[model samples]
Target: MRWFWKWYLWSEDWKVEGSFPYHLKKMVIIVAPHTHWKDFILGVAVRSAYRFTYVKFLGKQELFKPPFGFIFRWLGGTPVDRRNNNNLVEAVVQKFNDSESLVIALSPEGTRKKVEKLRTGFYHIARQAGVPIMMVGFDFKNHKVIFDEPFMTTENEAADFERITNFYRPIEGKIPEQGLMHF
Candidate 1:
Protein backbone atom coordinates (compact mmCIF):
# COMPACT_ATOMS: atom_id res chain seq x y z
CA MET A 1 0.00 0.00 0.00
CA ARG A 2 2.86 2.34 0.79
CA TRP A 3 4.51 1.72 -2.52
CA PHE A 4 1.21 2.08 -4.31
CA TRP A 5 0.57 5.45 -2.68
CA LYS A 6 4.10 6.57 -3.42
CA TRP A 7 3.55 5.75 -7.06
CA TYR A 8 0.17 7.46 -7.04
CA LEU A 9 1.57 10.63 -5.51
CA TRP A 10 4.38 10.60 -8.05
CA SER A 11 1.98 10.09 -10.92
CA GLU A 12 -0.23 12.88 -9.61
CA ASP A 13 2.73 15.25 -9.36
CA TRP A 14 2.43 15.56 -5.61
CA LYS A 15 5.29 15.59 -3.12
CA VAL A 16 5.65 15.60 0.66
CA GLU A 17 7.97 18.00 2.45
CA GLY A 18 9.70 17.72 5.82
CA SER A 19 9.83 14.60 8.00
CA PHE A 20 7.51 12.99 10.49
CA PRO A 21 8.83 12.97 14.06
CA TYR A 22 9.17 9.36 15.17
CA HIS A 23 10.18 10.00 18.75
CA LEU A 24 6.77 11.26 19.82
CA LYS A 25 4.54 8.23 19.44
CA LYS A 26 1.44 10.15 20.51
CA MET A 27 0.51 13.56 19.11
CA VAL A 28 -2.21 15.60 17.43
CA ILE A 29 -1.90 16.23 13.69
CA ILE A 30 -3.90 19.12 12.27
CA VAL A 31 -4.30 19.51 8.52
CA ALA A 32 -5.52 22.83 7.20
CA PRO A 33 -7.16 24.33 4.09
CA HIS A 34 -9.45 21.35 3.87
CA THR A 35 -11.78 22.70 1.18
CA HIS A 36 -12.24 19.52 -0.81
CA TRP A 37 -12.67 15.79 -0.33
CA LYS A 38 -9.41 15.25 -2.19
CA ASP A 39 -7.69 16.45 0.96
CA PHE A 40 -8.56 13.16 2.59
CA ILE A 41 -6.97 11.20 -0.24
CA LEU A 42 -3.84 13.31 -0.09
CA GLY A 43 -3.67 12.83 3.67
CA VAL A 44 -3.87 9.04 3.38
CA ALA A 45 -1.25 9.04 0.65
CA VAL A 46 1.12 11.23 2.63
CA ARG A 47 0.72 9.06 5.72
CA SER A 48 1.54 5.95 3.73
CA ALA A 49 4.45 7.66 2.01
CA TYR A 50 5.83 8.63 5.39
CA ARG A 51 5.24 5.11 6.73
CA PHE A 52 2.99 6.46 9.50
CA THR A 53 0.84 3.45 10.30
CA TYR A 54 -0.42 4.61 13.68
CA VAL A 55 -2.18 7.70 12.36
CA LYS A 56 -5.94 7.68 12.80
CA PHE A 57 -8.56 10.21 11.68
CA LEU A 58 -12.09 10.83 12.83
CA GLY A 59 -15.10 10.51 10.56
CA LYS A 60 -18.77 11.15 11.18
CA GLN A 61 -20.62 8.33 12.89
CA GLU A 62 -22.80 7.97 9.83
CA LEU A 63 -19.80 7.01 7.81
CA PHE A 64 -19.17 4.13 10.17
CA LYS A 65 -22.28 2.34 8.97
CA PRO A 66 -23.09 0.30 5.86
CA PRO A 67 -20.75 -1.89 3.81
CA PHE A 68 -18.14 0.84 3.53
CA GLY A 69 -17.72 0.93 7.30
CA PHE A 70 -15.10 -1.81 7.23
CA ILE A 71 -13.15 0.05 4.59
CA PHE A 72 -13.09 3.23 6.69
CA ARG A 73 -11.95 1.28 9.74
CA TRP A 74 -9.22 -0.38 7.69
CA LEU A 75 -8.11 3.10 6.69
CA GLY A 76 -7.70 4.03 10.36
CA GLY A 77 -10.98 5.90 10.68
CA THR A 78 -12.53 6.38 14.12
CA PRO A 79 -16.22 7.05 14.36
CA VAL A 80 -17.07 10.41 15.93
CA ASP A 81 -20.57 11.42 16.90
CA ARG A 82 -20.68 15.13 16.14
CA ARG A 83 -24.34 15.60 16.87
CA ASN A 84 -24.56 14.95 20.60
CA ASN A 85 -23.09 16.70 23.60
CA ASN A 86 -20.15 14.37 23.66
CA ASN A 87 -17.03 15.36 25.50
CA LEU A 88 -14.79 14.59 22.55
CA VAL A 89 -11.69 16.28 23.88
CA GLU A 90 -11.80 14.47 27.21
CA ALA A 91 -12.57 11.17 25.53
CA VAL A 92 -9.67 11.59 23.15
CA VAL A 93 -7.39 12.65 25.97
CA GLN A 94 -8.33 9.51 27.82
CA LYS A 95 -7.57 7.47 24.70
CA PHE A 96 -4.17 9.05 24.48
CA ASN A 97 -3.52 8.26 28.10
CA ASP A 98 -4.61 4.65 27.66
CA SER A 99 -2.51 3.98 24.59
CA GLU A 100 1.25 3.91 24.46
CA SER A 101 1.21 5.51 21.03
CA LEU A 102 -1.48 7.24 19.05
CA VAL A 103 -1.50 9.93 16.40
CA ILE A 104 -4.86 11.47 15.60
CA ALA A 105 -5.40 13.85 12.71
CA LEU A 106 -8.13 16.51 12.61
CA SER A 107 -9.05 19.54 10.55
CA PRO A 108 -9.35 22.70 12.57
CA GLU A 109 -11.83 24.17 10.15
CA GLY A 110 -14.12 21.23 11.01
CA THR A 111 -15.52 21.29 7.49
CA ARG A 112 -14.59 21.65 3.84
CA LYS A 113 -15.83 25.22 3.66
CA LYS A 114 -14.54 28.68 4.24
CA VAL A 115 -14.39 29.64 7.90
CA GLU A 116 -13.61 32.92 9.59
CA LYS A 117 -11.78 31.18 12.40
CA LEU A 118 -10.49 27.70 13.06
CA ARG A 119 -12.03 25.46 15.68
CA THR A 120 -9.87 25.17 18.79
CA GLY A 121 -10.61 21.55 19.61
CA PHE A 122 -7.33 20.29 18.19
CA TYR A 123 -5.38 22.74 20.32
CA HIS A 124 -7.29 21.77 23.45
CA ILE A 125 -6.85 18.10 22.67
CA ALA A 126 -3.09 18.48 22.34
CA ARG A 127 -2.90 20.46 25.54
CA GLN A 128 -5.08 18.06 27.50
CA ALA A 129 -3.29 15.01 26.10
CA GLY A 130 0.10 16.55 26.89
CA VAL A 131 1.12 16.03 23.28
CA PRO A 132 2.50 18.28 20.64
CA ILE A 133 0.53 19.47 17.62
CA MET A 134 1.81 18.58 14.18
CA MET A 135 0.74 21.19 11.65
CA VAL A 136 0.45 20.05 8.04
CA GLY A 137 -0.36 22.27 5.09
CA PHE A 138 -1.93 20.90 1.94
CA ASP A 139 -0.82 23.41 -0.66
CA PHE A 140 -2.61 22.19 -3.74
CA LYS A 141 -1.37 25.12 -5.76
CA ASN A 142 2.21 24.01 -5.22
CA HIS A 143 1.32 20.34 -5.23
CA LYS A 144 3.13 19.95 -1.96
CA VAL A 145 2.23 18.55 1.43
CA ILE A 146 4.27 20.65 3.84
CA PHE A 147 4.89 19.69 7.44
CA ASP A 148 5.89 22.11 10.14
CA GLU A 149 7.78 21.51 13.34
CA PRO A 150 5.63 20.10 16.11
CA PHE A 151 4.27 22.90 18.34
CA MET A 152 3.53 22.70 22.02
CA THR A 153 0.35 24.48 23.00
CA THR A 154 0.48 27.45 25.35
CA GLU A 155 -2.12 28.96 27.66
CA ASN A 156 -2.48 32.02 25.45
CA GLU A 157 -4.92 30.95 22.78
CA ALA A 158 -4.81 34.18 20.80
CA ALA A 159 -1.07 34.15 20.33
CA ASP A 160 -0.96 30.47 19.52
CA PHE A 161 -3.71 30.86 16.98
CA GLU A 162 -1.89 33.77 15.39
CA ARG A 163 1.13 31.55 14.87
CA ILE A 164 -1.05 28.89 13.28
CA THR A 165 -2.72 31.40 11.00
CA ASN A 166 0.62 32.79 9.89
CA PHE A 167 1.98 29.32 9.12
CA TYR A 168 -1.02 28.48 6.91
CA ARG A 169 -1.40 31.88 5.24
CA PRO A 170 0.55 30.91 2.15
CA ILE A 171 -0.82 27.46 1.55
CA GLU A 172 -3.50 27.27 -1.13
CA GLY A 173 -6.20 24.63 -0.99
CA LYS A 174 -8.02 22.92 -3.87
CA ILE A 175 -10.85 25.38 -3.44
CA PRO A 176 -8.89 28.45 -2.56
CA GLU A 177 -11.97 30.58 -2.11
CA GLN A 178 -13.44 28.08 0.29
CA GLY A 179 -10.32 27.76 2.37
CA LEU A 180 -9.66 29.59 5.63
CA MET A 181 -10.56 33.25 5.17
CA HIS A 182 -9.14 34.59 8.41
CA PHE A 183 -7.77 33.65 11.80
Candidate 2:
Protein backbone atom coordinates (compact mmCIF):
# COMPACT_ATOMS: atom_id res chain seq x y z
CA MET A 1 0.00 0.00 0.00
CA ARG A 2 2.66 2.48 1.05
CA TRP A 3 4.79 1.44 -1.93
CA PHE A 4 2.12 2.41 -4.44
CA TRP A 5 1.36 5.67 -2.60
CA LYS A 6 4.97 6.77 -2.49
CA TRP A 7 5.68 5.92 -6.11
CA TYR A 8 2.67 5.76 -8.39
CA LEU A 9 -0.04 7.67 -6.51
CA TRP A 10 1.21 11.26 -6.31
CA SER A 11 2.61 13.25 -9.13
CA GLU A 12 6.03 14.81 -8.71
CA ASP A 13 4.63 18.36 -8.88
CA TRP A 14 2.16 17.80 -6.05
CA LYS A 15 2.51 19.95 -2.93
CA VAL A 16 0.60 20.37 0.33
CA GLU A 17 0.21 23.60 2.28
CA GLY A 18 -1.09 23.48 5.87
CA SER A 19 -0.22 20.66 8.19
CA PHE A 20 -2.94 18.39 9.48
CA PRO A 21 -2.81 19.28 13.16
CA TYR A 22 -2.61 16.53 15.77
CA HIS A 23 -5.15 18.23 18.00
CA LEU A 24 -7.94 17.80 15.51
CA LYS A 25 -9.37 14.34 16.05
CA LYS A 26 -12.51 14.78 13.98
CA MET A 27 -13.19 17.33 11.22
CA VAL A 28 -14.54 18.24 7.79
CA ILE A 29 -12.30 18.56 4.73
CA ILE A 30 -13.59 20.38 1.65
CA VAL A 31 -12.35 19.71 -1.90
CA ALA A 32 -13.10 22.59 -4.20
CA PRO A 33 -13.70 23.59 -7.83
CA HIS A 34 -15.21 20.21 -8.56
CA THR A 35 -15.34 20.86 -12.27
CA HIS A 36 -14.62 17.41 -13.64
CA TRP A 37 -15.14 13.76 -12.82
CA LYS A 38 -11.36 13.47 -13.02
CA ASP A 39 -11.20 15.33 -9.74
CA PHE A 40 -12.30 12.13 -8.04
CA ILE A 41 -9.30 10.26 -9.44
CA LEU A 42 -6.93 13.00 -8.38
CA GLY A 43 -8.42 12.88 -4.87
CA VAL A 44 -7.31 9.27 -4.46
CA ALA A 45 -3.79 10.15 -5.52
CA VAL A 46 -3.65 13.03 -3.07
CA ARG A 47 -4.93 10.93 -0.20
CA SER A 48 -2.49 8.16 -0.85
CA ALA A 49 0.42 10.59 -0.99
CA TYR A 50 -0.52 12.15 2.33
CA ARG A 51 -1.11 8.74 3.88
CA PHE A 52 -4.48 10.12 4.96
CA THR A 53 -6.31 7.36 6.78
CA TYR A 54 -9.36 9.09 8.18
CA VAL A 55 -11.37 10.03 5.11
CA LYS A 56 -15.01 9.17 4.42
CA PHE A 57 -17.42 10.81 2.00
CA LEU A 58 -21.00 10.64 0.74
CA GLY A 59 -22.43 9.66 -2.60
CA LYS A 60 -25.96 9.36 -3.98
CA GLN A 61 -27.86 6.35 -2.63
CA GLU A 62 -28.32 4.95 -6.12
CA LEU A 63 -24.61 4.22 -6.24
CA PHE A 64 -25.12 1.83 -3.34
CA LYS A 65 -26.16 -0.92 -5.72
CA PRO A 66 -24.43 -4.22 -6.53
CA PRO A 67 -20.69 -4.77 -6.95
CA PHE A 68 -19.76 -1.08 -7.25
CA GLY A 69 -21.55 -0.33 -3.97
CA PHE A 70 -19.40 -2.79 -2.10
CA ILE A 71 -16.25 -1.27 -3.60
CA PHE A 72 -17.40 2.23 -2.68
CA ARG A 73 -18.14 1.21 0.90
CA TRP A 74 -14.77 -0.45 1.23
CA LEU A 75 -13.20 2.75 -0.03
CA GLY A 76 -14.91 4.80 2.72
CA GLY A 77 -18.08 5.96 1.04
CA THR A 78 -21.41 6.57 2.74
CA PRO A 79 -24.71 6.51 0.86
CA VAL A 80 -26.71 9.71 1.17
CA ASP A 81 -30.40 10.10 0.46
CA ARG A 82 -30.28 13.53 -1.14
CA ARG A 83 -34.07 13.83 -1.15
CA ASN A 84 -34.37 13.66 2.62
CA ASN A 85 -35.39 16.93 4.19
CA ASN A 86 -33.49 16.20 7.36
CA ASN A 87 -30.40 18.30 7.95
CA LEU A 88 -27.24 16.55 6.73
CA VAL A 89 -25.16 18.66 9.06
CA GLU A 90 -26.85 17.15 12.10
CA ALA A 91 -26.35 13.68 10.74
CA VAL A 92 -22.66 14.34 10.09
CA VAL A 93 -22.28 15.72 13.59
CA GLN A 94 -23.73 12.50 14.95
CA LYS A 95 -21.15 10.54 12.97
CA PHE A 96 -18.38 12.64 14.46
CA ASN A 97 -19.65 11.85 17.91
CA ASP A 98 -19.72 8.18 17.11
CA SER A 99 -16.15 7.99 15.86
CA GLU A 100 -12.97 8.99 17.62
CA SER A 101 -11.27 10.12 14.42
CA LEU A 102 -13.68 10.93 11.64
CA VAL A 103 -12.64 13.06 8.70
CA ILE A 104 -15.32 13.83 6.15
CA ALA A 105 -14.43 15.35 2.78
CA LEU A 106 -16.98 17.26 0.72
CA SER A 107 -16.90 19.20 -2.51
CA PRO A 108 -18.16 22.71 -1.85
CA GLU A 109 -19.10 23.10 -5.50
CA GLY A 110 -21.41 20.08 -4.95
CA THR A 111 -21.43 19.11 -8.66
CA ARG A 112 -19.43 19.19 -11.83
CA LYS A 113 -21.68 22.01 -13.01
CA LYS A 114 -20.72 25.60 -12.26
CA VAL A 115 -22.58 27.54 -9.58
CA GLU A 116 -22.58 31.12 -8.34
CA LYS A 117 -22.17 30.04 -4.75
CA LEU A 118 -20.46 27.13 -3.07
CA ARG A 119 -22.53 24.87 -0.88
CA THR A 120 -22.45 25.71 2.83
CA GLY A 121 -22.87 22.15 4.07
CA PHE A 122 -19.16 21.76 4.79
CA TYR A 123 -19.25 24.75 7.10
CA HIS A 124 -22.41 23.67 8.88
CA ILE A 125 -21.06 20.16 9.40
CA ALA A 126 -17.80 21.38 10.89
CA ARG A 127 -19.52 24.00 13.04
CA GLN A 128 -21.99 21.50 14.40
CA ALA A 129 -19.27 18.96 15.10
CA GLY A 130 -17.03 21.59 16.75
CA VAL A 131 -14.18 20.63 14.45
CA PRO A 132 -11.86 22.53 12.17
CA ILE A 133 -12.14 22.66 8.39
CA MET A 134 -9.30 21.44 6.20
CA MET A 135 -9.42 23.21 2.87
CA VAL A 136 -7.80 21.26 0.00
CA GLY A 137 -7.34 22.64 -3.48
CA PHE A 138 -6.37 20.92 -6.72
CA ASP A 139 -4.60 23.39 -8.99
CA PHE A 140 -4.53 22.23 -12.56
CA LYS A 141 -1.86 24.76 -13.53
CA ASN A 142 0.92 22.54 -12.21
CA HIS A 143 -1.23 19.57 -11.30
CA LYS A 144 -0.52 20.17 -7.64
CA VAL A 145 -2.69 19.57 -4.60
CA ILE A 146 -2.52 22.44 -2.10
CA PHE A 147 -3.74 22.13 1.44
CA ASP A 148 -4.77 25.46 2.95
CA GLU A 149 -4.85 26.42 6.59
CA PRO A 150 -7.28 24.21 8.45
CA PHE A 151 -9.68 26.41 10.38
CA MET A 152 -12.37 26.29 13.01
CA THR A 153 -15.55 28.24 12.33
CA THR A 154 -16.23 31.13 14.67
CA GLU A 155 -19.33 33.35 14.97
CA ASN A 156 -18.82 34.69 11.42
CA GLU A 157 -19.71 32.19 8.72
CA ALA A 158 -19.57 34.54 5.74
CA ALA A 159 -16.13 35.87 6.51
CA ASP A 160 -14.84 32.41 7.16
CA PHE A 161 -16.16 31.25 3.80
CA GLU A 162 -14.55 34.13 1.96
CA ARG A 163 -11.24 33.40 3.57
CA ILE A 164 -11.52 29.82 2.43
CA THR A 165 -12.64 30.74 -1.09
CA ASN A 166 -9.90 33.33 -1.58
CA PHE A 167 -7.25 30.63 -1.70
CA TYR A 168 -8.92 29.02 -4.70
CA ARG A 169 -9.65 32.32 -6.44
CA PRO A 170 -6.24 32.72 -8.01
CA ILE A 171 -6.39 29.34 -9.67
CA GLU A 172 -10.06 29.63 -10.55
CA GLY A 173 -9.17 29.54 -14.23
CA LYS A 174 -8.69 25.79 -13.86
CA ILE A 175 -12.36 25.44 -13.01
CA PRO A 176 -14.12 23.65 -15.84
CA GLU A 177 -17.63 24.60 -16.85
CA GLN A 178 -20.61 22.59 -17.96
CA GLY A 179 -22.64 23.68 -21.01
CA LEU A 180 -25.30 25.19 -18.74
CA MET A 181 -23.58 28.44 -17.76
CA HIS A 182 -26.65 30.49 -16.85
CA PHE A 183 -27.42 28.44 -13.77
If scored against the real structure, what TM-score would every candidate get? 0.95, 0.85
Q: Give the range of the ten consecutive residues with the poorest summed lDDT in model 2.
A: 173-182
**lDDT tens string, model 2, 12-47?**
555655665546678788887677776776777667
Q: How high is the CA lDDT of each candidate model?
A: 0.89, 0.73
Q: Once superposed on the true structure, which residue ranges of model 1 sit more than 4 Å away at CA? A: none
- Per lDDT, the best of the predicted structures is 1
Candidate 1 lDDT, tens digit per residue, 43-162?
Answer: 989888778877999877877898789988999999888778699989999999999999999888888879888988889889998999989999999999998999898989889899
Q: Which stretches of candidate 2 lie above 4 Å from their native place? A: 9-13, 172-175, 178-183
